[model samples]
Target chain A: MTDVTCFSADCNKSKLFWGLLALGGLVMLSTLSAYFYIEHHGHIVTGMNNQIVWGLPHVFAVFLIVAASGVLNVASIGSVFGKKIYKTRSPLSGLLALTILAGGLAVLVLDLGRSDRIIVAMTHYNFKSIFALNMIFYTGFFAIVGLYLLTLMDRKLKPWSHPVGFLAFLWRLALTTATGSIFGFLVARAGYNSALYAPMFIIYSFAYGLACFLVVQTAMYKWNNIQIDEYVLGRIKNLLAVFVAASLYFTAVLHLTNMYFAKQWDFERFILVEGDTYPMIFWLGQVIVGGIIPLLMIFSPGAAKSPARILIAALLVIVGGHAQMYVTIVGVQAFPLAIFPGYAETSSFFDGVVHPYSPSTLEVMLALGGMATTFLLTTVAVRILKFLPIDKLDQKH
Target chain B: MTASHKPERRDFLKTGAVVAGAAIAPGVLFYGIAQGRAPEEGASSLVRWGMLIDTGKCANGCTACVNACNTENGLSGKTGPQDSQWIRKLNIKHLQTGIEHNLPMLCQHCANPPCVDVCPTGASMKRADGIVLVDRHICIGCRYCMMACPYKARSFVHEPLADQNPDVPRGKGCVEACTFCVQRVDKDQQPACVEACNADGHQAMLFGDLRNPESAIAKAMLAYASVEVRGDLGLNTGVRYQGI
Candidate 1:
């Protein structure tokens, strides 16, 4: 590893930094404008109808919330497990977690039909609801992360940071589980009514969060001309391989479990084998390209040590994880359970019986805005604050 | 140092005790508040709003109930199957026996309602009288209740609504279902659909106080064996179908 001086003021001088901030700000304004317009007029502005009550915004919101959990992995590794390699990067990881949380919240607010009544969600708590529990966990997690970051800034408060870090790790795990239970506890809806969703989310959080963190870290290192140790990068590649394998296994088990039960076979087959939109996403996008291809790239001896090849695998894992979330949440609802079987099965796809949905252009723009917000916040923190410890490399074990 | 440290240790213990007490205080206060407001105990005064659907007499093709509900509730034009089905006519056939039955289905208003159980915001709740209504003002549009409902009775207002009946107070980001015409019931009038059913001379749909023995639904329940959908779940649903 080559030693590089802290770019005292150069962090603020990057062209990408300014560009991302401007783009992020513009996106936020546009999303806010759309939200207010819809609020005043009603939900008629969106494409969602009765059968497909949840559409693109719901999918994106859940995706962002899940991704937010993943963004905390590096911090958990460094602070909770006391990993030396990750120590310098802990604050950056915290910043990522915070930014992702904000993005997640924004997507949720925008998805609501009454955006102004969001406060009602807080005031009215249904103790029986896993979704309500998740809201509470989300709030607590944010508060804890804020406190942890503040504690890190004061050298005198360092001794107390470990407990805070431990709590953050435990809280994040709980938060992710709660998010999973939001869907898992739905016993009525065939696609989502399962216990598997909870643990599956936690596993993907580790895989996706680590991949996202590495992408940003690698990009930053390149921009600053900082050299990363071959040993560290090698370890990360190995970790990525394990995460990708686990994620693939979780997904396979979910499908297999549903198939094993003959009664559930109709809905399972409809979504996995027969459905038009679902089969392509489940097989090509999520399973083969997202899972098998990435698994091969990471585990194959020929490609294992190559940094550039490993990054591609990581990217695939992120894309696959995201696609999985969409299919799991949105695709399952596409197949309508007919209350009456004797009547001719109404072809909902052709007839307007089923609501047709594809994200409107503005919905896509809002989702991109969420990602840009994450990037811009992280960039500003790295530039203006001592988020990454510049002196950690020089310290002896 | 020992003498001074003794007072410091006592002070530390006191501080620790106070902090622990503070943490536990909120839980205790919440419990007390819940208990204090507990309703007067007697034979349950809660109105148990229920419906009795006579499948034997239901005219399969006559969509009078659907139209009547749409007109009375001020719902927009019927767009999709799932959006607005306060009363849906279904042709059910048992796969094993090939038994066919034409049934009109709506919110069953279960005593142990799954929708109410899963609502994160308590927006979906059974009134003391057993009518399951969603408080639209409080819903965050999370849609957990929609997934929990066994009959798929709930619908989400995904797009903004216009031309809403000012009395109804519809909003987006909330789950809604048939309230058995709660406003009409409160006014001591029959549900609009029920009125429409009677006016069409079908007499297939019946509404009454389940608690009153002389009511038509109660008399019908006694005369004929009434059936509830998915009765195995034991939700004690208010809506019962006769001769299904």
Candidate 2:
């Protein structure tokens, strides 16, 4: 864990890096302990059960996985779209993609009922399953993105970065499609049946990925006492705003389309107005705090000059991203399946009523582990390598 | 290669004994058939096991079938939110008519099971005889199959189990559902639920091979207006309900 190669002549910079690493390591250890405890005690210890099978861990896992694809958007803009300022941020973007995905994937694998048999899960194939396809897409994205990062960093491989970057871009589109389809393809529940999920998640990644990039980049600048230019900052925030608007539009369409059908009316009411945690999260956490406020902050007069306001806006987007995932994953499962239409059913198996869920402390710890893993790995990698973007006044890609 | 050259004696008497013993040894020999099929034999595709449930004959508040299933599967019989219920008695009412019905709900064993289709490791699989089962040996317990099931028939074991029925294998961390009582079915016997229903004089559930036209369940289904639950899903579920 202490294999840091400091780039600066003064060794004093290494002390802070080591201290942050230790803090991350402590959290990582606690996360692993939670994993082991659940593994030994079984899922009975967790709030999850037959109903609400996926809980808080899934929210964190899916958020990170979906955002990981979005994180690569910075690199894609630089290499494939030929944005010179974005080119400066490509390495950091690529690094974030890997470390964040590792964290998300770790939570998913660790939360499995039979995590020890992960090998068998890989060897076994069910091509009809969207989950299986996502596994392949996730693995391929790592390889292509890793290569894309290498090509962008090495002088000799610079010429090939564009082609690799293009491949990575296409692969991520397929990746996000597969990710969204995990819920969309499911017909057992009313909340996930819409085909709009694929495109909606794609736009969400753009917003989430850009917001993540802005937060990390701003923090890096603040940490190093560097002042980011106003023009470059404005351009990036504008892109983020457009994505947020597109994502919001798709979300409205998804709900409106479902509302058009009488069959989906109950589910719509439950999620948007009737249900307890979901409606509040969807309205306050996702829509207001995540969408409107951030858009206002970004487009506000003199906003580009204030880095703190922009950073807060970006942080809010991340918060809203988690809220969106929570409402999508946990909220959907909390509603019981409509097995018998035109019938009010009740049983010991919880057939007709709304399922209850309360996240246990262990479950919360496990969820935080995914974020901690990303932070720990990112901290070490950034310290060891030169990931800072250099923005010249007349930069050319 | 001549038989006469072998040190061990070869005669028609020994060969005759083998031929005669083969006919009678099914129940007696160590390697012979024990329950319908020999140990090495697989579930036959010639049979598509099914059930026909007449809700009119199923009395409300009766839990004989549910009790029988729990006892047969070695379940704790707890009805908590986290408890595993391979089968349950669902009390449903038609909102338009206000007519109520109580039916024992379990795995429908659909010809096209969504659980089987969505399982990442092919652990939620179907036997040749049309019995949907979880191969716990390979099941990684992702629970994706549970989300795909329209019937909500599946249950994931939440706690470590003990003193399980030797014939019915179950474990924590794997998704499970009704197999039409596969162990009893393999032995050419009716499921415990069907037996309990009959013993209770409800005569509600009829189990037989759907592929065979002369089978009692088939004849009954043909003579009656039996329909598959969630038939709109186009699943062609093996379990049919009558008088709903």
Candidate 3:
């Protein structure tokens, strides 16, 4: 085991830090521009309609939101699970979680019909609605994680870190559960309406959060020119593989269960084979490239020793997670709701037909803005705060 | 005695005129209220407004109800994928038997509305009188209501609205569905669709208070079996259909 120290001082001023901040700012500006354009011209100028209400923006928002919870797993491992290596990195983990959540929420709020009346959402309460419950859970995550971060960073309050960390861990799990249930509880759709989404989302969070952590950890180390111990990287890579496998397993179960029911035959066929882009995304984007390939790379012989291979796996997992969300959010809506059991129906509203959706330029910009928000905040946070752990590498692996 | 009789006759005529004026004034005022005034503030749960459509009476080529709803609700009736349609005429054909049917579909207005239950801000709500509506003041336009609705009854306002009926205010970015023309209902009149259908002589759509045992709709419901669309979900919808 290596002895670790904490860095309380501001990070050394570097061109790299300024460059990332500048890029983040540019993306955020474009996002704001898109928001204003949509706000002024209305959704009529965009591709979204009555049928496919939730579109590309939702996919990005949910991805960040789910990833935010998963990102905290590192801190949970450190504080709740009592791992020495993870414990030192708890502050950074907490910070990343908070920032990423903020980004996701920004996209969700801006995409609303009355973005100006956000206060109404804050004041109103429908206790039975899962969406309302999610509002509460989301706000609680920030407050709880904020406290956990303080407890970890403040030397005098360090003793309380364990308890605070435990609370944050439980809160995130609940938060992710609520997020998943947003789709699962949708009894109207054929694709969603299953309890499996809750656990599936949790497993997804694990994979996504670990992958994100690896990327950030690698970046910080490379920027500082510090030699990361091969042992540390190996542990994280192995854990990512396990999480990815678990996510794939849950997906299999969900499809298998759907296959068992004859009623789901049409929906399954649409998603698996007949759908326009949905089948391609499900098979190519989600299953093979995103899931199987990443798993193979992670479990390949001597793969853990190479940081590059692990990073590649992390990137693939992220891509796959996004594809999975696209299928879940957009593809589900694209498939028409089954109103009549045995009748072929037609109407002016594109009923009984697959609704086509392609992301607009504005939507893409808005989504990228959410990503930029996370990046900018994370950079500013790490530079000012004592987020990076001081690593003491051992020569012998 | 003759002079007294004359005065008495005159007095009787004046009293009769006064009584006639008093009786007619209320009817005129009610007509005015029906034309322009808003619904009274409180809607009671005692009155469950519902619709029962007799498919046997619905004509295949008739779109009078759809047109009436658009005009009443200030919708364009453009039939674009994104245009607001408070009501639509659906043509359904049985896959196995080759049997065909046509019906008008709108908000089921369930006793347990999924849209209301799923609305994040309580914007999609059912009034005490069982009229489901979106509280536009709070609807963040998330479109979750649209997703939750079994009937593709709801529409999201994609474009800024102009020339809207002052009583029916619509703006961009909010999800809206048929309000059962609560304005007309409050004034003790049938919905615009029902009126138009009756006017067109189709007489397929019947509107009345379901709770009142004596109501025409309730009586008709008793006479013939009515089925709620997707009734197996057990939402207990306020709207019902016959001869499906």
Each model's TM-score? Answer: 0.85, 0.94, 0.92
User: Model 1's chain B TM-score?
Assistant: 0.78
Between candidates 2 and 3, name the one with more favorable lDDT: 2
Whichever of 1 and 2 has more TM-score, that candidate is 2
On DockQ, the candidate that comes out on top is 2
RMSD of each: 15.1, 4.5, 6.7
Candidate 1 per-residue C-alpha lDDT over A59-131 given as tens digits, one digit per residue, 9 for 90 to 100 = 6667667777877877777788888777667787788888887777777777676667778888888888887
* Candidate 1, superposed: residue stretches over 4 Å from native: A1-12, A301-305, A338-356, A389-397, B1-46, B81-83, B95-99, B158-167, B172-174
lDDT of each: 0.74, 0.90, 0.89
lDDT of 1 by residue, B75-192 (tens): 6646464355555666665666776666666789898998888887787888877888998767777666766777767677655567887767776556677888877776678998
Clash list (residue pairs), candidate 3: A113-B140
DockQ for all models, in order? 0.24, 0.76, 0.69
The residue-by-residue lDDT of candidate 2 on B29-102, one tens digit each, is 64544535865798889999999999999999999999999999999999887789999999999989999999
TM-score on 0 to 1 scale for chain A of candidate 3: 0.95
| iRMSD of prediction 3 | 0.8
Specify the poorest-scoring 10-residue window by lDDT in model 3 chain A. Answer: A4-13
Predicted complex 2: DockQ: 0.76
Give the CAPRI rating of model 1.
acceptable
Question: Which 10 consecutive residues of model 1 chain A have the lowest summed lDDT?
Answer: A345-354
- Per-model tally of clashing residue pairs: 6, 0, 1
